[model samples]
Target chain A: MDKTQQSHLLIEDLSVARGERILLGGISLRLSSGQIAEVTGPNGVGKSTLLRAIAGFFPVRSGRMSWVESEAADSAPLAERLHYIGHLDGLKSALTARENLEIGLRFLGRDRRTPLQALDRMELAHVLDLPVGYLSAGQRRRVALARLLIVDRPLWLLDEPLTALDRHACALLKAIVAGHLGSGGLTLAATHEPLGLPGTIQVRLGTR
Target chain B: MTRILLVIFVRDLMLARRIGGGGILGLVFFLSLVTVVPFAIGPDLRLLSRIGPAILWIAALLASLLGLDRLFQADQEDGSLDQMFLSPAPLELIVLVKCMAHWFVTGLPLVMLSPLFGLMLDLDGPALRSVAATLLVGTPTFTLLGAIGAALTVTLRRGGLLLSILVVPLAVPVLIFGVSAAQSATISFLTPFLVLCALGLASIALAPIAAAAALRTAGE
Candidate 1:
């Protein structure tokens, strides 16, 4: 894997809409390597929308979102450089956890670890063979978290990453985010609870 | 790119097989449709042989639409569609690969079983081979067309009926050529069969692009 190089996302006056009704507007933020942007807002405020728009899931109404890398000017499309964990886990419950992660790893490219090792990292090595449907919500969340470890990407877009986690799983996630940030990776998460990590930049939606 | 497409293909295939009902549902639907037909048409052997290919083609076409509404709906609801859009592979190719895998799971079986159903229709050996061959080439077109419908309606609560409606009209050309080619076992089969092939090839090349665009429109 290439050594962690400097990368940053620059968003200016980013406004996103759903159909006619505008969900959020006039949002400006800059996230650089090693910084976490925790988007907070009232329910229905579109914290998820901003992160998703940044992930290239929706068309921005009006704004300039640019990516700057120290290594190259025109880097790969933003999709390949990021990992998006949305409101729903992008997993096939019919497949085992190992199969799920392996499919993600194979599809996402840049395999950093085997599926077993990633699950082991998430304390889910034992449930690797179980169908994801049988796992509890917390276990399923961790299995989804294992996705981050298997594929190496610089940007992590997490939506409600802490929903079903026990205190222990939260700690695991915190440590994982710390490691990712330490390696100069950036995270933009939409969550109600604070990530409990130092120096996390907060962006609130549905305000102003 | 190939790796990503291959995994998607394999994953979809595995899901289709493990889900246990898609293939069987399509087969059972095709069988029931055929079984119910002779009751209406009566057991006139000559009449049945003449119209056997059309009956089989219509049944297969409807059955191909059976499991298609779930094609993108499952992925959409599970959030896999968003992740898929985020993949480096082009969405059009991914859509194509998905439809191809879906056909492998659902459409091919109907083709494989057409001969037995043809026998029930009292079709001769040449007609049996023609039905199977035409269906083998023709079913993928149905799936490709249905995929476009599936992607367009991925977000609706109950899109199955709408999916069939949207797909069947567009599928008329495929149905026409497929039935014609299958019925031409005695006459020069090459003409209609070539048209069927062209229609299939054209849909294969174009349906994915339209489906991918629809998914993008309905995605967010």
Candidate 2:
């Protein structure tokens, strides 16, 4: 296996709150390259909130997170090195699948693969020209998933990535996650279902 | 940075075009405001001409707000706004790009059609030219400042009304200077026009920062 130098992410005693309720508290984790952390719990367990905190979507009420590239502490903006897919799918209703993928890659400043190639990898080649709003829920999820492939970011924060996926699409997702891990990348997924990837670390969250 | 900005700008323009309502809605609102003023004031051509600049500025201001709610609302609903937060480009730059795109789609057409609307209100050559020119320079400031309000109200369900309330007060100076520039076209148009430009330049520099901060807080 051709392995690049690993990146390290450390979170210490993280806490998140919404209004008067504490969603998560005293959470800590360390992830390096080629690692996958699966956040599993029932609904309203802060699985999504934890992922959002790591992706910098929500404020961390306490504690800190540090990302180190190779041997040095990387102070570059987290967004530059991470790709985040949330529950909304992020597809513009008027745009085609290909256009969404292309614009998404450009917006992220990643140009590794063409939109067509990325959609092809997601088995969306046949519907490349159709508007995303016209796509089914499963198909739209595939298009969003295709963004992870088009952009070559090291850290992927996926919130319920498999929610709308069918059996075949779920298999494709597993393959993609595995392939991403094989190439010294990090994935933090918040899902209720089993990710079923080898050597994955499971972090279960519950109401505080 | 330029490439990313261009990509966002182009994508927004495309969305505005395909979505098929924002620009047209603003233009139609502008047209109705122009046409209705004659009826409301009983077809007094001189009176219409006298208040033409104010009417046009008022109409333009209201029309600009017609689609302001959609500025960030659609992106927030569809989750592209969150994706935008993750872009390497600073959120301020993204806000700037979105504002520019909004101006291009909504403001530009209103400016282009203002002269015709001015003619309807019996504005002569100098008056019409001044109105168009003022709109060309002033509407960008309107859109930029309005972007902040839009960002602030993006998370709300009926944000359109609140957006107008928030934006209209901030727009008072632009309205005053814009109408003044048109009224003084026969005198020293340069002075008020220059002031309008200054306000525009200031808004261009400041609104994006404020709007980006509002968006971040709203996300939180």
- How big is the positional error of residue B162 in model 1, measured in Å on the Cα after superposition? 0.8
| Residues B121-179 of candidate 1: C-alpha lDDT, one tens digit per residue | 88999999999999999999999999999998999979999998899899998888889
The C-alpha local distance difference test score for the whole of candidate 1 amounts to: 0.90
**lDDT (Cα, tens digit) per residue for candidate 2, span A151-192:** 888899999998889999999999988999999999999988
Clashes of 1: 0
A1-208 per-residue lDDT for model 1 (tens digits) = 2446889989999888878977678888899998999999898788888888998888889989988888895479888899999878988899999999999898888899999999999988999899999999889889988999998899999999999999988998999999999988999999999988989898978565
Lowest summed lDDT across 10 adjacent residues in model 1 chain B is found at: B15-24
Q: What clash pairs does model 2 have? A: none
